[model samples]
Target: MEEVYGFEMSDGTGDFFGYTADHLFADIWTRPGLTDRDRRLLLIGMLAGQGAADVLGIQVPAAYANGELDDEALREIVIFVCHYAGWPQGARLNSIVEETIAKAARRAARAGESS
Candidate 1:
């Protein structure tokens, strides 16, 4: 497979062209003032709006890496945002939150086994 610019280019995995992804995509993703949990929420909302489900899967689990977010906490965020952002946006976020919650549990379980 040809390494298109920096990404490991593959036809089956994804068809990202690399220019928008490599340069602009990587930079504006993780900004300051946003905790890992906050970043996860923002990304999930944006992904939902744009119908970017693939990236949502990759990011949702990351917030829980530091244990800063939990199932209940994310649920609250979803609830709060729902009141203002409307049900459609909230539903999308809720689904991703559920996915993240599960991911957090799995990671915690693995950590417990190690110790």
Candidate 2:
């Protein structure tokens, strides 16, 4: 984040970024024909092209928490992108997806057991 955006992202700075991110996203990414999940996946694709799988991977949960994604759907998106985006990119994203999925599944499992 500091490398790309030049901001030291503490909670205060991040709050400002969040506000701007929300407005900017509501304008462009949420344009006609795109849902928030679509916008998130699109952003992920673009970021992937720039070799930013770490951020992309981390954003998956945020997207889900923000009501932009579901796990099964994300699985398909990753596989579909793998076909069009090539093996190296696919391999990189695969690690991200696997890690994200495992984290989500673990969280879900823990919640279920506690319930």
Candidate 3:
């Protein structure tokens, strides 16, 4: 699998990223039960419900970049989630999704300019 996303764990983080690499990514993500697209959708919903914005900041863009989701689909998910997860959480996720999409656009524009 391609390494589409990554982050540096801080010095005193006690092997957090290492364990994530060894266990979460290397093991769980490699499991055959779900395709990457399926995993992304599941993760997006779970994170949105739990109001995990920081992780969403990473995942939302990755999902878009990898074609796991699009703006309309994400918008629909946000709307659906609002009824269950509350309006505030949905609103927060909307902002995070908007920011992620905007950043993706900027990156694409820069890549176009250089090409």
Measured by TM-score, the strongest candidate is 3
Point out where model 2 deviates above 4 Å. 1-10, 14-19, 29-33
Report RMSD (Å) for each prediction in the order shown: 6.0, 5.8, 2.9
Worst 10 residues of 2 by lDDT: 1-10
- What's the distance in Å from true for residue 101, model 1? 1.4
Of 1 and 2, the candidate ranking higher by lDDT: 2
Backbone-clash count (model 2)? 0
Best by lDDT: 3
Candidate ordering by lDDT (highest first): 3, 2, 1
Against the true structure, what is each candidate's TM-score? 0.53, 0.67, 0.80
Worst 10 residues of 1 by lDDT: 1-10
TM-score of 2: 0.67
In model 2, pairs of residues that clash are: none
Residues 11-106, model 3: lDDT tens digits: 534577678767888888889989887888788888988999888888887788778789888888789878888998899889988887788789
Identify the superior model by lDDT, candidate 2 or candidate 3: 3
Q: After superposition, how far is residue 17 of candidate 2 from its true place, in Å?
A: 3.1
